[model samples]
Target: MSFLELKNIHKSYHLGSQTFPVLKGINLAFDLGDFVSILGESGGGKSTLMNIIGGLDRNFDGSVTIKGKALNHKNEKALDTYRRETIGYIYQSYNLISHLTVLDNVLVSLDMTTLSKKARVLRAKELLARVGLAGQIKKYPNQLSGGQKQRVAIARALASDPKVIIADEPTGALDSENTKEVLRLLNEIASEGRLVITVTHSEAVANAGTRIVRLADGKIESDKRIRQAYDRQDKEHLSSRPLRRLASIKTAFKHFRHNLGTNSLIIFGTAIGLFSVILFSGLGNGVSHYISSQITKVANPQVMSVSRYVKDSDDDNALSMSTDDTPALSTNQLDQLKKQKHVAKVEPTYSIPSATVSYQNQTVKMRYASNWTAASTADAIKIGHAPKKAGEVVIDQDAIAKKLDKEHYQDLIGKQIQLAYQTNKPSGETVTVSLTATISGIGHSDSKGAQVNAVNTETLQKAMQQAGLSTDPTEASVKVDTLDHVEEVASSIDKVKDGHNRLYKTSTIQSLIKQLQTYVNIATFVLSMVAAISLIVSALMIIVTMFMSVSKRTKEIGILRALGESKRDIRWLFIAESLITGVLSATVATVIAYLAQRGINGVLRNLADYTFVQITFRNVITAFFLAIMISLLAALLPARRAAKLNPIDALSAE
Candidate 1:
């Protein structure tokens, strides 16, 4: 059996129902160590016949048998495997990837082997040395002479140790000296027991080989043998495999570095979009935190004020103050609240919308006077302290400024004050409850709202009882163990119901803090979304850049396909480039955000005594991955288009 055989091969090209025959029932047989050349005129189908024998042109009606095993032209994967394991191509144009050095061009073929990386590099160096371009391995194709570039191509073709070497007009573009040198190399390759096939139109080029098969009018005109074939030798060949993903990534990086100027502009534009999003997120977080701190200073976060639910009332005073018509919390409700989870203590208290206070001969009317409880924080008191025992009261700075001694308010702390308020009895008769209380502390208001006047609950209740009035508590202060449990405890309290209506109404500093935070979050999300619109532009830029890359590297794609790289490998090459761009852009965005955070916080700290921009670790990671996902999605269409290109058409593209 022959090493390779083609029987009754017929091929034609179609143009709108018209057929042009290229090959007609051609029959050929080749053996190992045979240097055969297919010689013909320009329109005689010499290259087409060579393409069929090299496993490149599979759309032909023929049986291509290799050592008695017929090739399956219908199965593309099998054909690709056949090409990778058996055939190597050398083009007249030298087809070396421009971005790669001579050594790397050879390594591209070796990358599809099962050899170790170290062994692959060593083998590539050996091939370059054997091709007489050892010192030129570090140079690119444009930096080398035509003869040297042809040597690189020959080294690359021999890198995988294929059984058949296909040279298509290999000496057409060289001078006589270079042509003789290339022909000698082809003879040496055939001497190693491998079949060498050359396609040419020159008689001298064809006669340099062992045999010549001349084609005329799509038919073999003559089959002549000029020299005997060399003796075949048994030798081990390098194992082959599909290209690895790491190899694609390395190639992508080389292309990325070659176009650094354009890629840098893209990275900067993408970084601006990401930086705005990150900065807004951090700003929202800092604003929420600052508001919570300021509010907590005036009130205790873990302490909430609870009152009996009132229907259809929008008045704040009506919700909190107890009246003859309004319901008050029963003993049962208070006991249930005390037994609730995370509840530290519950204290029943009273509130008076209006109260009169007199010290010596001076008198003043105070608003929002209530019994002192844990709901009030000591931080609100600018002077003295909170009311601790019976007969003690804490008056606001406003009352002192109105009627009391505003200039010497500290003098009233140790003095006694007369307090009186009007309430209803059980029979619905209005009566006045008055008592003498010591002014233990004076409160102040930082906000524009009214200040609170607090007194001991026991003192007020005792006075009400002595005045023949009901002393049932109007409100309760529920103290939670920690601030985190305040919301949970409030939720449980809200769930407690008397029939269909809620049993109690709850209010706390924590609830106000949460409402403020929700507002900040909504604003931040809206701003971030607006900033994200710029990413759409960034994605489009990447798509354009990738499409340009595909257009520019069409020939490179063909060269890779001829070297045994699959279509999937081509797709990943572009995708890897986009992903690298995304990673660099995200890194630049993170650095810019960090620096802006520092600068903005520095200025705000001097004005408000607070940091107004806080960027979390979560934000950084989220931005990084978001950038990668966008870039990956953007590269898909261009990569797919690049992968779907026809290898023959791509190779012929100018």
Candidate 2:
């Protein structure tokens, strides 16, 4: 039995409804160590016969038997395996990958073998040295001479130790001296106990082999042998497997570096979109922090102001409404609030929409005045102390500076001031109430143009009683035991109700800060979304770039497929390249965001005494993964198109 055999092979090509015959019923046989040449004219179907024998043209009627086992041509995986493990091809055009060096060109085949990486490198070097191109290993194909390029192709054909080597017009592009050198190499390959087949139209090239088969008009005309086959030997061959994902990624990176200028621009474009998102997120965080700090300076976090829940009331002055319109908390409600968990104390308070203070026969209108409670912090008073006694009050520093004394504002802390305000009685009549109290402290508000004055609850209530008006608690300040319990206690107070209507509404410094932060977040999200429109453009750019890559690398795809790389392997090659692009873009965006954060914060700190941008680790990581996901999604259509290409047609592409 022969080492390899072909029986009754037939093939044709279809142009619309017409069929053109390429290979007519041809039978051939081969043995190990035989150098056979298929000699023919240009259109004699010699290459078609070679393709059938090498397992590349499977759409035919033939039984390709090797060592008594016929190939299952219908099974693509089996055909790929046969090509990987049993056959090797050398093209006359020297179809070397342009981006790879000579050494890497040969290792492309060796990457599928079951050898360690170090061992693969050593073997590649050995093969290059054997071909007399060891010193040229670092040079690319375009940098090598024709003879040197042919030598590289020869080394690559033998990299996997395939049993049968197929060369298609190997010397057609070489000079006489290079042709002679290449024939010597083919003869030497035959002597290694392997089957060597060459397709050539040159009679001189055909005679260099041991046997010759003449082909004409898609049929074999004659078969002649001048010498016998070489002696056979038993040896272990190099094992082959499917291409690994890491190998595909390495190749992709090489291609990426080859096209760095264009890819760098893409990375920069993508980075701008991601930078805006990260910057906006950091700005929101900083604004929240600043607002919380400012409010906490004037108000206690552990104390919350509680009032009656009014439905659909848009009154701007509702907090300072007259006693008749404002809902007064009953004794029962006060007892319930004091009984709540985490509640330390509940103090009733009163307020008026407007008031006036008389000092040394000069009068000035105040914005508003209320009784002091736990909700008012001592930290707000810039001088003197909080109002403690019934006859003491805290006046805003700005009011004193503008109305009474500009330079001597602190001197008015111990002076007596007459305060008067108006309220409504139960009979629907309004009257004025007056009280005299000492200015015990001067308060300050961080909010611009806000003037708040405070007096003791006892003093205000005493003045109201003397005016024949009912003085009930209009609001209460519920003091929590700890700052952390403020939110919980406030929620409980808000849930207090009379039948279907909610009884009380709770407000805290923390709640105010949260509301302000919510507004900031909405604005940040809107701006970030607008910035994200650029990301769509960036994705389109990536998609266009990958499609262009697929068009440019069509021939490279054929070479890989012929080397037995699976469709899945080809798909991941493009995906890996895009992923690298994404990661680099995200890294650039992160660096830019950090730099912008520093620059913006530097200027804002000098003007506002606060840092206004704070980028977090979560933002960086979110941007990183978002970039990767977008790139991966963008690569899918192009990669699939690449994987679906026909290996035979791809190898024939220019």
How do all models score by TM-score?
Answer: 0.85, 0.90
What is the per-residue lDDT of model 2 for residues 269-305, given as tens digits with 9 covering 90 to 100?
A: 9999999888999998888888887777776789888
Choose the strongest candidate by TM-score. Answer: 2
lDDT of each: 0.87, 0.88
lDDT of 1 by residue, 436-461 (tens): 88988888765446585888888988
Q: Candidate 1, TM-score vs. the true structure?
A: 0.85
Clashes (N, CA, C under 3 Å) per candidate: 0, 0
The lDDT, on a scale of 0 to 1, for candidate 1 is 0.87
Q: Which candidate leads the pack in lDDT?
A: 2
State the displacement of the C-alpha of residue 184, model 1, in Å, after optimal TM-score superposition: 1.8
Off by over 4 Å in 1: 295-298, 313-342, 348-372, 377-474, 481-488, 499-501, 508-510
Q: List the residue pairs that clash in candidate 1.
A: none
lDDT of 1 at 478: 93
